[model samples]
Target: MTALFDVILPVFLVVGFGYLVCWRRWLTEVAVDGVMRFAQNFALPVLLFGAIARLDLGANYNPLLLLAFYSGALLSFALGTGLSFYWLRRPIEDAIAIGFVCLFSNSLLLGVPITERAYGPEAMLGNFTIISVHSPLLYTFGITAMEFARARGQNLSVGGVALRALSGVLHTPLVIGILGGFAMNLLTQAGLVMPEGFWAAVRMMSSAALPAALFGLGGVLYRYRPEGEARAIAMCCCISLLLHPAVTFGLGRIFALNLAEMRSAVVTAAMPPGVNAYLFAALYGVAKRVSASAVLVATGLSMLTVWFWLAALP
Candidate 1:
């Protein structure tokens, strides 16, 4: 019980408080979006950067764990794509979107924060291990798949599409944070000490990242409404909330992940679909309806499912 209160209660309380206030009109949608952006673009990067720059990351490195994590993610992606194409009879573009909806975990906004709150901040190192590759790999695959779908009727250059996809990877703030932090870590390893004041400033912003993210998450839920085909939304939610985590856990065991890695991987897998998926869908003009509905449904229900998984974790 003490562990429950200490580990899990704080996370949900902040999230519930965020929802309550948003529902009560204490925070506007614009305000929430601003806070989310502030956290994602600036605070999260600083926090992650400081983490890598200061920590002795080599002590916990696990290449096998990464292999296991990716195996699970790829399996989920393939399953979702197959189901979307065959079961739902969606177009190629929509099927890729469905696969991404399953594969792209909300690692930053909800996964890292919740894992930190539940297990402790060090758990986030494992998360960083996962997120470092998550975006670049999955986004590239999704974009390339979408490009191929778009090629059916147009004179689309595959190399050009691949270039655009890679550009997206470069432009992502989280990826920049990982790369920058890695460079700093290398410098630290080479005997360059990070300044006390600079670390402090970054820490200050980093401290607010979790709370602001939780608030923004709740606000997003409050404002979100499901539309379009209910069947598609339901299928995507199942893949996001259930199948992904199950496969992650199974693969973790098979790949012999340590306790921390297993927990981190499974928890991240269980998080709702990334909110950015809707943006991609909207931009590409495919699966927008299903993506929007999936985020809302998976996020809302994850309030319960997340806790269940945390409690179930050994």
Candidate 2:
């Protein structure tokens, strides 16, 4: 317990401090936005780029890890939807919303900072592997699910949905980081390395990512405090905080992922539902209240679960 505290406490301290600052109005919303954007858009990308660039890409990359991680997510989604319809006596639309919340995680904003803090910079490569594809895949699943949940007989244009998903993939910072780092690593493998001076500046930006990100997480929690249906909220908590990570750990073991890879898969799976889960629900015009309630529930529960996963990591 002492050892675990030594590892995970400082990160939460930064998070709590950020929460306090925001609660006290020590920083304006605009200033908070600036700090979050700096960390999210710039610092995170740079850190991911550097970390990925230095990796032995061929050996380090593992597609099966993604499979294992998503398998758990899909299971959790199914469980949430099942619980909604059968037990909660909710509509199918509400079930869809519950499923969506259980599936997506706040990997970038919360997961990255927490994983980096607990496991150090190297574990970020594993975290990056998940973050890179997180949005694009979830976006596709989210859109399709929402479409089905609402009305159930509408036809979405395949080409249009594909285009939108592709566009999102192209614009995400995680994708950019992975691609850029892979390019750099490719060049290094061919005997050309990045200039030391250039890398030092990248490292400087990278250094700000964890602290700024933790602070930004606090700000985000303040920004989105969703409220509605306690039963739906409790369902989200069970799926996200308990079932998701448990299943992820099982899958990781079955896939024979290394310790670092296992830790990455389980830790990320344990994070709270993405804030966009609420946005996705809002956009689809289905289960908005259920989704909002789930977000708040998952966020509150994750403060403790995050520590459990970090400490339990192999």
Candidate 3:
């Protein structure tokens, strides 16, 4: 309980401060957009690079741990997707949006900073690994799901879709950053010398990423007004905050994860609905209302859910 309070409460306090500022119109929408653009294009990439560059991905890196986390995430996403389609009887696009809402998480925005505070810098590695492994899944299968729903009657070719998907992954700053950093690490492991100046610059830039990302998230939430899509959003928030984490906790224990790793897995699983849901919705012309609503509700509720998880963690 003490651990939870100590670890999670402060994060909520900071996020709450941002929300208050935006709610009061102290931070204008223009300001938020600029901030998000900068964070997404620059700050996040630098952070990913720096974190991955420093990773000692040698024999000690646990493939099983990565597999466990991936399996849990995949199962949760599948269950959510199936439920949204069958139980809710939503249109394909809306179902895809709900599926992503349940699956993808704001691990970068919320996970890294909070984990660093709670468990230290080393814990960030777990998040880095998870993101790296899941990036391909998100870019390919996730986006395809959205496209399939949106282009229900369109004659979209498989080859064209594959090419576009590959291009999207190649163009994404986050993906590039992860790959770049991993490549750098590999080269360094093979006895290449990274310039001190480059490392120092990346380190400094990366330090700014987390706070900026959080503030940007707050700004996005401010722009999102939960007027109509309340029911769908609420359902997604329940699944994300409750069902996902519960499953992760059970499976993590079954995988025999240590306390630190289990905590990391649980917290990651409990992360807010991803910003990507909104992005993908716009791209695929899905249930934009529901996607936006999910973002707002999940982010708002994450404060409470995170607190609960922290409190529950041993």
Q: Which is the leading candidate under TM-score?
A: 3
Enumerate residue pairs that collide in model 2: none
Candidate 2, residue 237: the lDDT equals 88
Better of 1 and 3 by lDDT: 1
lDDT of 3: 0.76
TM-scores of the models, in the order given? 0.90, 0.85, 0.91
**Number of the top lDDT candidate:** 1
Model 2's TM-score against the true structure: 0.85
Candidates ranked by lDDT:
1, 2, 3
Residue 258 CA displacement from its true place in model 2, Å = 2.4
lDDT tens readout by residue for model 3, 1-314: 65456776676666666677889999888888888888888999888888787777863366766766666666767877787788878876678777877778777778777777878877666777776656666667777666665566889987777777777777888888888888988888889997899889998888778777777777777767776866677777888788877877887778887776777777787788778868877776777778788888888787778878877778
Off by over 4 Å in 1: 1-9, 55-57, 153-157
Candidates in order have lDDT scores of 0.79, 0.78, 0.76
Clashes of each: 0, 0, 2
Compose the digit string of candidate 1's lDDT tens values, residues 211-245: 88777776766665787788878877887788778
